[model samples]
Target: MFEKILPFTRKKHVAGLKCAFTGHRPQNLPFRFDETDERCLRLKAELRKLIVQMIEQKNVTHFISGMALGIDTYAAEIVLDLKSQFPFITLECAIPCETQAAKWSERYRNRYFGIVEQCDKETILQRHYSSDCMQKRNRYMVEHADLILAVWDGKPSGTGMTVTYARSLRKSVWTLDPNTFSVTVE
Candidate 1:
């Protein structure tokens, strides 16, 4: 699927390394639903802390995301917030296909489009949408990233596919296991 996008060149570029994030659209609270306000606050706090650690430890100056409903959107929002402090933190929107945002609800579409507008780069995988196109997009993301941050619920889905591809590439992969409250890399 990704026969075109070349991997990052090793020429001594002054910019920081690029890190992409791929994960399932989290259906749990603070993502899809709002349970207790306190829990929501706590979860947000933890997420921010983790994101900060990734930026500091991984030297991630750029974040690439697909703008999906749950995990992708959350990661993008965190990157946007971190941009204020780390102004060089770039957000790149890697859409599976043109008009892919149309598949989402109107509100979500608007929000996602707004984020794309704020991004430093936006790449469309195909001129049209297809079931297989998302897999192609995921492959493209894994190909370009120095590291991948995956927020997973242990489901076998697109996130799993992305993780598999990243592993095959031998890229640094960090996973936030919501079940264990820990990060692990294979």
Candidate 2:
């Protein structure tokens, strides 16, 4: 597996442009129910538009998603939707563990697993599960991506850690503040 690891470089490459996604798990009921309220729906639409614009402007050909709840799942959905218009677009599922899906609710678990099955590629970080291993998976995503798409609510949490790691790597990052709907490029 160590031999399979590749160094991530600053220069854009030809195989595909990869963007990793991470974000806070939505705390509100709207996200819990998997039903988009009016505000969330509007925000989701706007996010989709911004992502598509970025894909076009940056010539992104592949999107890598951790497939965690909330923002990661949403980003994958958006990229999958865009695949119709950009046939070359591919989604890679970077799952934290082999059995992580078992922790989610049946509905959500099925939905997430379905996406993983449908993705162009899926990379499971560990054969077994552990709290620390999840963190390692997040770090792996940050290390591999050329860019990061983050959804932040201006709080310190796991998503913050991801943002910090991306910054340290000097990878391009784009963020959407859930509270303000303002997009920031870092």
Candidate 3:
């Protein structure tokens, strides 16, 4: 099962210019992950730069977000902010299940809805959660995207799993460190 790893250069080679995002939650952040935290702000800034590069430099027009908290939410917001400049850009929310955020605090839930409301498309995986639902969502994004922007800390988790799968599928993966804010392409 461990074969067929290919290096991807850019999204332009794919059928459509599409990309996806994955990352750790706020709790996994090295510094305070609060909205106003300096580290968090810096992370957002780095994400903004990368998103812009995807749009202007890489010719990516569509972005898929899992809609999870932390990097996922931040990435989605950055794409939305970029719409004013790249008006043709589109955001697709690929939710794992209807109750995917049911356990989140009200604050996070509100933020999630706000992002979803503005998304160009929404694909809910299932009506209820399953043991494999999140994995399925990750696969869905990887299967649809030509590239994946991953905010990871070189650790083993869902984000890492997605990155590994992306590489196996020969999709371009850009990994960003939550602590250092550096992006390395694989």
Candidate 4:
């Protein structure tokens, strides 16, 4: 009955409840990578608040995480923890490449793959690493999300680039400071 609706002309499925996450790796964070670190614990608490806001205030039901080491992994874990309360919320993993975590430590690699296994969906941008794969993954998240949750230090980083790209797309970005555990809309 709708054969005339061309692919490009057809209305896209715009998810009203979509959010993406971006953040710096462990080395870039101001604190040690241990979850028990005071800094890490504080950020985890704050992230729980933000995700709750997204669910209760913004009606965000779908979350996308890049699954990187430091902040991204923590954010994904928080979302997974919240799933028991917000049963409808879904997590999606956007990986840059198949071998993205090849060089990571065994523990981190296992964590990354575990999260990937639990995600509702995964989009692998490339089979192998390319200079632009990360950027491409960032762009995909920006294009798909209604909002971006970034853990940035207000410096030059891939996280910063993702935030800039989200802003350019007219997507609202909530930036979190790893140093002070503060969130600002930029």
Pick the lDDT winner: 3
Clashes of each: 0, 0, 0, 0
Question: Mind giving the per-residue lDDT tens digits that candidate 3 earns over 1-186?
Answer: 011222323323233489999999888997645788898889999999988888878889889999998889999999989887877777889998889889999998999999988887888877789999999999999998999999999889999999999999999999889888878987
Candidate 2 lDDT at 117 equals: 65
Estimate the overall C-alpha local distance difference test score of candidate 4. 0.82
In model 2, which residue pairs have backbone atoms overlapping below 3 Å?
Answer: none
lDDT of residue 50 for candidate 4: 92
Candidates 3 and 4, the one with greater lDDT: 3
lDDT of 1 by residue, 1-186 (tens): 222332332335347778888765646533454424564455556667777887787677878898887678878888888877877677888888877878678888888988887777788888888889888888888988888888776678788888988999999888876545467876
* Residue 169 CA displacement from its true place in model 1, Å: 0.7
- Residue-level lDDT for 26 in candidate 1: 42
Task: Go through the candidates in order and give each one's C-alpha lDDT.
Answer: 0.75, 0.77, 0.87, 0.82
| Residues forming the 10-long window of minimal summed lDDT in candidate 4 | 1-10
Where is model 3 poorest over a 10-residue stretch in terms of lDDT? 1-10
Q: Write the per-residue lDDT of candidate 2 for residues 32-140, one digit (tens) a residue.
A: 5444577577667877887787678887777888888777888888888887777677788887778877868898898797787678777888878887866887888
lDDT for each residue of candidate 4 in 1-105, tens digit (9 for 90 to 100): 001111222233334579999998888877767777888888888888998998899889889887778877988888888877876777888888889999998
The worst-scoring run of ten residues by lDDT in candidate 2 lies at 1-10
- What's model 1's overall lDDT? 0.75
lDDT of 3 at 186: 77
**Which scores higher on lDDT, 2 or 4?**
4
Badly placed stretches (over 4 Å) of model 4 are 1-15
Please identify model 3 stretches exceeding 4 Å from their true place. 1-16
